[model samples]
Each structure stands twice: as C-alpha cells, then as structure tokens.
Target: MWVQLRRSARTHVASVKGVAWTLFLFTYTDYKTIFFPVTAFACVAAPVQSYTRLLHGVIWIWLNLLQCNSSNQYKSAEEDALNRPWRPLPSGRISRSQASKLRWSLVPICIGFSACYGWDVVLANAFLTLTTIMYDELGFAGHWLGKNFCNIFGYVTFEIGATKIIGTSTALDYTAMISILYSALVIFTTIQTQDFPDVIGDSALGRVTIPIKYPEASRKFTFVAMIAWSVFFSSTWALGTLSSLIFCVLGAYVGSRIYLLRTVQDDKRSYVIYNVWLLIAHLLPAQTRWNVLPF
Candidate 1:
C-alpha cells in the first residue's frame, strides 16, 4: 500500500510538471517582482507560506487548464498512446470526472484568494481564465492567435494581476517595460521551441503551428531570428548589470539549441532536449542575479 501510494504520488507529480512547466516558464518574471503580492494573496507571510502559494498557484493554473476542454484533447488518449500513461488524463490514474470534481473544488479557493488581494487581481485572474480557455478550448496556442494576442496576454496578465493584487503604486518605468519586453521575447521563443516536440502530434491533428507553417529551408532562419531577438531583448532589458552578462550566456546556450533543431533529424531527442534546454536557458538568468521563482 505504501509503495502504491508512493507510485501514485510520483505519477501525479510528473503529470503536474508536464502541465505546470508552461505557466512556470512564462511567469518567471512575475515570480521575481510580484513575490510579495503572490504570497499575500495566498495568505502566506513566511518563506514556507510563499513556497506554498507558489505551488498553489501552479496547481490552480493546472486545475484551470484541466477543467477546460483543451486539456482533455491535449492530454488525450492519442498523446498517451504515443507517450506514457503517468499523466492524469491519459494514464487512467484519474478519470475526467475525478479531475473535474477536484478542479471544481479549487475554483472557490482560487477566486477567493485572488479577491483577497484586490478586485483588480480578481479581474486579472478572470483575464487569465478567459485567455487560457481561449488558448485551449479555442485552440489559440496551436494557431496564429497564440503567437499574437495570447503571447501578449500571458506577459501582461502576470504583471497586471500580481501588481494589482499587491496594491503596488509603482508606475511602469523603463526598467519594468524592458523586463516585460524581454519576457515577451522569451515567451515567443518558448512557443516556437514547444512546436518542435508537437510536430508529429500537431501534424496528425492538422493543427497549424510554426513547424507546420514553415518549410525546412525556412525554419533555420526563423530559429536564428528568434535567438537573435532573445539576445537583443535580454541585452536591452538587463543592460550594464550582472544580469546582462548572465542573459548573454544563456542566449548563447539557447542559440545552440536552435542550431540543433535546425540540423538534427532525430525527433525524440531533439524534442526532449529542446524542452530541457529551454528550461535551462530560462532558469539561468532567474538563478543568477534575479533569484526569481518560476511561477
């Protein structure tokens, strides 16, 4: 029984990370700047509370996604057949009904906690909910809409939501704007990097994505352009600081990943390394000077 329980817990954690990384990577900036507001909203005053809130937010985000129709399709049987069964939806570890019941149970807690911070924060959460619903249920992430509007929404919502909840009166400054811009560039790279893994699955589903739209010849240029922009934005955002140096190094690391994607034909390793390297690139700057938690 103990072993079974341990196995179950491990499976859930993998499922959580699978779904969790998207929100986590995109919101790293928020983790740094809005740490206080996030903690307050979660009613956590200490380090422990902050960690709890961080976990809670990720779980809440995942729950919100699971409650949406897109989560089911994305984590559908087809994907499970291709991958592993440890995922909550595909593995039969948790039924759709069970997941829905659990997610529904958290809605009140999510809303109430956001409201505790401020009405604006609550509104921000609403924005997040709507955006995610559209991204998943409407298939925005797999299409052009995700590249345009959804990209903006992810960056803007995190900043606005956390700041409003915290009641921070700080006006948007050059530094903050730079941070947002750098973060947005990173988000776009994430979207592109994510496409390599989904190429087979998305192609099977006839989903439009960067990989689907661009031919092989054109992909390398696009990959290079993304890496260049990453470097440009990071330099602009963290100029003259130790953060800038770290960002430059991380950008090089990400550039190598892009090169691999261009040259490598091995689907499985390329996809997995694309994801792993992306995480490393994002984590580097956050760990260096920012010490920001990724969502």
Candidate 2:
C-alpha cells in the first residue's frame, strides 16, 4: 500500500507538470516576474513598500495566468490538437470539463483578490477577464489584429491592476501611459511571431495570423520592428530615461539575432527569441529603478 501510494504521488506530480507545460506557465511566470517588479517599483517608489506589494502581485499574476491560459486551452483545444498535440487537453492528460471547471473556479478567486486591493483592481481584473472571454468565445483570434488587440488589452489591464494595488491610483500617469503604449507596440508588431510555432494548428482552424497571412512579409516585419524597438530603447537610454546601458546592449543583441534569423522559418526559434525580447523589454522599466548605469 505504501508503494502504491508513492506511485500515485509520482503520477500526480507528472500530471501537474504536464498541465503546467500545457498552460505555458513558464512564459506567464516570466512575464509576471518582469512586469510585477517594474510596476511595484514604479508605483511604491520605496524598496520596503515595493517588496510588500510584490507578494500581492505574485498572487495576482498566478490568478491571471490561471484565468487566461486555462480558458485559452479550453477554447483552443481543437486547434491545439493539431498544432500542439503534447498539451494537456490535446494529449488527454486533462479533460475539457476539467479545464472549464478550473477556469470558472479561478474567475471569482481573481475578482475577490483584486477587490481586496481596490475597486480599480477589481474593475481592471473584470475587464481583463471579459476580454479573455471575448477573445476565446467570439473567435477574435481569427484575425491577427484582433489577436494583438486582445493581447494589448490584457497587458494594459494587468498594469492597471498592478498600479492600483501598489499606488492606489486608478488614473493613468505618464509612466503608466508610456508602459501601456510600449506594451501595445510590442504586442502589435512582435506578438505575431509567436504564432509561427502554431501555424499548422492555426491554419487548420482557419485562424488568420501574421505568419499565415503574410508568410514572407512576417519575418521582414518582425525584423524591422525589432530594429525599431532597439533604437527606441537605446535612444531612451541616451536621453537618461532608461537607466541601464545593459538594456540597450541587450536590445541591440536581440534585434541583431532576430535580424539574422529573418530568413529562418523555425517557429521554435522565433518563439524563443520573441520571449527573450519581451523579457528584456519588461526588465527595462525595473532597471530604470534598481540598476541605473551611471554615465
């Protein structure tokens, strides 16, 4: 009986790992790691206060991940079967009913948590959740523009909630506005590359992503956008708004890498590069606060 119990524990652990991979928890965790710190640093403006808020931010991030990824998986199960057969839903590691139940369960928990922060946080969370529902149920993912818009909306909502939690401010200030704009630009221009890995699945589902809609142009566009982003960050560094030379160097390196891979059609590489670029971008704001390079 002890041996059987140990085997059962191992099986449960393996199943959890499979679900985590299916939900892209690593990517979401990376996003929160970069975003929440920056938001807390920017709003709280003190290390002690920022650290305090960080705990709440972590919970918010996990709730967001659960709400977004699970719903996405439940909605995109059919397409995922073609594009990502290894995912929990597609691989039969989890049932659709289970995923649906998980998603619905997370919704109230997220809203309640946000309510603890403030009405602003609650409102932002509600909006973000609504947008996620629209993106999945209304087939907004069918168009590249719609998909990008959804992403931007989600990120903005996240920032709003974070800002409200940290600063108790619901109004968009200069920093918040700039962050939103930068994130929107990133979502609009570079997020398309993420679809590269799932082209087959997306195509099978008749989804119109940039890689599918403009196969050749997509690479060129992404390359150019990376260059443009690099220049923007470098210029900000020059202007003293961006605090670190490392981010400038990192941006240049990522841009150059993407440029070199402009001709490569590997979705995995594109996905990896895109994630790297995003992490760098998210880290820039935090660097402005914590790791300013003296000129």
lDDT of each: 0.50, 0.68
How high a TM-score does candidate 2 get? 0.79
* TM-score per model over all chains: 0.61, 0.79
Tell me, what's the RMSD of every candidate? 8.1, 4.2
Off by over 4 Å in 2: 1-48, 167-172, 237-265, 286-291
Tens digits of per-residue lDDT, candidate 2, 49-88, equal 4567767775686677678878888898898777667666
List pairs with backbone clashes in candidate 2: none
Stretches of model 1 off by over 4 angstroms after superposition: 1-77, 103-106, 141-144, 163-174, 215-218, 238-246, 261-295
Question: Which 10 consecutive positions of candidate 2 have the poorest summed lDDT?
Answer: 40-49
**lDDT at 88 for candidate 2?**
68
